[model samples]
Target: MKQLQKLKILDLQDNRIQGLIPNDLCHLQNLGSLALSENELFGQILTCLRNFTFLREIFLDSNKLTSIIPTNLFNLEDILYLNLSSNYLSDYLPPHIGRLKAVIQIDLSVNNFSSNIPSEVGGLQTLADLSLAHNRLQGPVPESFGNLISLQSLDLSYNNLSGVIPKCQKRERTPPQTELLPTLAHGRIAYQELLRATDGFSDSNLLGTRSFGSVYRGTFTDGTILAIKRLDIMTDLACALDYLHHGYSTPLVHCDLKPSNVLLDEDMVAHLCDFGIAKFLGEGESIAHPNTLATLGYIAPESPQERINMREALAALKKIRHQFTQAVKGEKHEDCIALRGESVGSSSEP
Candidate 1:
């Protein structure tokens, strides 16, 4: 591989390749692109990869690669795309990540990364897509993230992050006309237009219904079909619970948090309707049992015996959401339920 100094691109993606990336391949200092994704490759990314100054893209996702990211890899200022997701990489993201000034997309999710996300990531002015989900990251999200002016998509879910997410300012610059999709040419539609599109939201157009709201299949005169969801209830419910549990001076717990207590306004924003059984906990207090119990099958299994705090309830809700998401993706999530059952059973012991 060292003899191939003129090799500009090395793409072996989706192959049956196994074993460590050859150190000899790093000798291709003039390489412009490297793609080895969806393979069985294991071992840390080659540190010498930093020497490929001319490289513009790197795709090493869906592999078994482990170890902390090489700090020098961030020095590739001209690299446009970088994907290291679905690996076993562990350790704090280096602050030098901001050095990728020209990077457009970055994916570092599904790893063992811990600690606060580097605030320097906000410096990637040209970044459009970023994902750090399904990791072990902790601490509040960086406020500097609001500075990502060109960001179009971001995912930071399924982590241990807390605190309010900073709102990102809208981008001032319009994308080039060449980049606009044909569907976007119609611009925004009005409520009456939506009603017409979904044929008055007839039962024939109904796609599905969940704890939140229903989804309908809408069709335009031009035959463009789209799925429209009515309300953003789940997010609103989560925010309400978070405020009650953490934002207030005296932590409040909605003892009965069933779907019936969730109401939606004309704007489709959910509001917690009934607080008849709410409980306020004093400082240093964690659990509180109200005189009235929540609806059966709605609260946790141990709720009846040992009352749980709002934080625990929120955690349980998130776990259920995660399990449901996994199941929808055709993944096995019985282990999560089994583990929860084991913990509940052990805690009930005398």
Candidate 2:
């Protein structure tokens, strides 16, 4: 492969190619495009890829690649499109990412990357699309992001990010005007009007029912369609737990958290019920041993021996939710489900 020095393009995407990306390919210094996405390739990205100075596009998404993205990879100052999404990449997204001044689209979603997003990323003036969703990133969205004048799409969802979004100023170049949806003055719709739009919440309009509440597809007389969730039960539950765990000086743990213990109001708001086994952690204490036990399946694994705190329980619930989502999406998650079942079965054995 090193003999292919003059190769300008190398596209072997969507194949069953397995194993590490060969280093010899880096010898093609003049390569303008490289596409190796949707394969079974595993291992870290080639560090030598930085030597491909003429490379314009690199597609290495939907693979089993792992480890931190090489800082040198961002040295491709002339590269246009970069897709490294759906990998197992981890570690802080290097601050050097700002060096890709000419890149237009960048997708690094569905990875294990952690730490704060570098504010330097907003320096990519030519960036049009950016996605860093479904990662373990924490901290507020960078205020510098408001400077992305060419950004048409941005996604940072499913992260531990907090704080207010920076208001992006009007772009220098205005896009064509198009009416995508009906404009509302105050973004408020009357309850009676909503009822009428949803046909009094009829079964035919029902979209889906989650553990918290039901969603409906509502169509107005003006041919406007909207997906409306009747209740924010999960959000309410999370808020209640947050209050119990952090709002008060002494953190309180809801020892028994199960479907039956959650009560819903007429307005479809969820309330935590049955705090009979709730325990308050002492100063500097994290876990507590209670005389009463929570429902078997609802209890965390450490509940039997070393009891878990509210935060630990919440983390376990989040894991379960992620697994459930994978199952619903029909991904290859049977092994995870089977392992969970085995663990539950073992826990039940006296």
TM-score of each: 0.50, 0.49
Poorly placed runs, candidate 1 (over 4 Å): 174-350
Determine which window of 10 residues in candidate 1 has minimal summed lDDT: 341-350
Count of backbone clashes for each model? 0, 0
The 10 consecutive residues of candidate 2 with the worst lDDT sum are 341-350
Candidate 1 lDDT over 1-350, as tens digits, reads 86899776788999999999989987898776799999999999999988887687899999999999999999888777899999999999999999998788999999999999999999898789999999999999999999898899999999999998788776775675644334455555567767988999886565444445566667876665566787656655654564455443555677666778776655465656555566666677666645443342233323244557856755655455445345445685453343234331111100
Task: Show the colliding residue pairs in model 2.
Answer: none
The residue-by-residue lDDT of candidate 2 on 255-341, one tens digit each, is 777789787755565667666676766667767645443442233333244456957655554444445445545774452343234
Indicate the residue-level lDDT of 179 in model 1: 40
Residue 47 displacement (Å), model 2: 0.8
**Deviating ranges (above 4 Å) for candidate 2:** 174-350
